[model samples]
Target: MFAEEQNPTTAVAGRRLSDQQAVAQFRQVVSRVEPVAERFCKQETADRENFDCDIQIVVDTSMEGRNAYQTYNDAGKPVVGFTIPMIADARNPDELAFVLGHEMGHHIGQHSHKQQQQAVAGALILGALTAYGQASATAANPYRYTGNDQRDMQNSIELGAGVGQMAYSQTYELESDVIGTAITKAAGYDPVKGARFFARPEGKRTANGRLSFWGTHPPDEKRLATVLATIEGIEVSGGISRR
Candidate 1:
């Protein structure tokens, strides 16, 4: 279904923009979307003290494949970055705008912060369980703690952290789509059209075997549906309302 919808020969995906054109469009999209995103961030985080809306949007020239991300710098300032290929792969300004909005949504949603907390909690829970099981076995057999107790706990903790991070991954993606749709529309872009960027059939890994955009942001019907639903809500409300 995705392949049919994002047919390279017939759709915008068919043509690749020049490096110069790609950069130009990205900058233009940023000019329009950045302010709106910042304002939205501020509005959403008004009650929080020192919640930084000073987002830094940048491009990673050294990275390969289509990808974008939101992270915090050492000073705790939000940073949204796009790989060079990600910019070049964008079919239109709306795509760039929506992608930028989505990245901003991650920060605004405080996803990273929440994910870290979840990781720590999950790790503790699983690690404690492992330790308790080890102690019980040691008491029962008196020889079960020969060597692998620490290794077992460490492995369990790592696995728990991964599971915890994944627990709300899909929900977070949908939430970001909702926020992105609002920001894209506010920035005068067609979010539904922009979201078509995700409709293309891609693999989890790129040619070099590194994780690709689709690897992290797996394209699915649910995501597109979320965008459409958000648009519907926006139209009904005559504007976006925080959820």
Candidate 2:
């Protein structure tokens, strides 16, 4: 049912999570999914970092837009934090687990810094291209030019970056979903119920046709389809198993 990719793997940048509200919610997510994710983290990263594989929930004031993420300082300390609105606004426990798992998935893939670095690099490259294009275009059509061309060029670069990022980022998201489902299940919740969490992306599906859910995330159908597959693999109650 999904259009692109689906599976819990890794993620790009996450929302800041160092605030009181964010901290409480992140702690709740940690309490629920750490058991399962911990093992995955150790396995994924070979326990090479100082993290000891225990996901720590913290608050971040610099975040906005219901985000969660893993961070590493220049000193090589790794931290995993989730945002408040992300968990608080979740439709159910599964969604919360999905967010937490996705963030943890970034750590699992050892891509926390790489993703952010790429995004920043993409922005810089786009900016430089925009300036160069503007200068060259000015020589060609100086009098007819509006700043919109630069904006459009920058937009295209960002758009391309976004698509490329999702191509890879979605892989991580799907991987995290799978891993998150297992963790949420192990935490004693029905992952099927948590699958509703995937619905949050639907709100962004305003356009129709081929571009639906293109810029924001992997298509909803793809996400739900993967989650359903995950649910099938787990030991649930009746049709939906509980851990």
Candidate 1 per-residue lDDT over residues 1-243, each given as its tens digit: 345555667555446888888998899899999999999889888999988888999988877667899998898889999988889888788889998999899998999998999898889899989989888888999955458777888999999998888888888888888899999999999998888887777788988888788888888888788888889998998666445
Q: Model 2: how far is 89 from its true place, Å?
A: 1.4
For model 2, residues 1-243, the per-residue Cα lDDT tens digits are 222213333221135444555456656756767777787667656747655576565655465545556776565666765445555555444556666675666666655455666666676676677878787878898796575985687686786566445445766667666666666676776665665555433444333323322234444665676777777765444222212
Q: Enumerate residue pairs that collide in model 1.
A: none
Task: Report lDDT (CA) for all predictions.
Answer: 0.86, 0.59
Candidate 2 whole-model C-alpha lDDT, 0 to 1: 0.59
What's the residue-level lDDT of 3 in candidate 1?
52
| Candidate No. with top TM-score | 1
State residue 90's C-alpha deviation in candidate 1, in Å: 0.5
* lDDT measured at residue 216 in model 2 versus the true structure, 0 to 100: 42
Stretches of candidate 1 off by over 4 Å are: 1-3, 6-14, 239-243
Score every model by TM-score: 0.93, 0.56
Q: Looking at model 2, which ten-residue stretch has the lowest summed lDDT?
A: 4-13
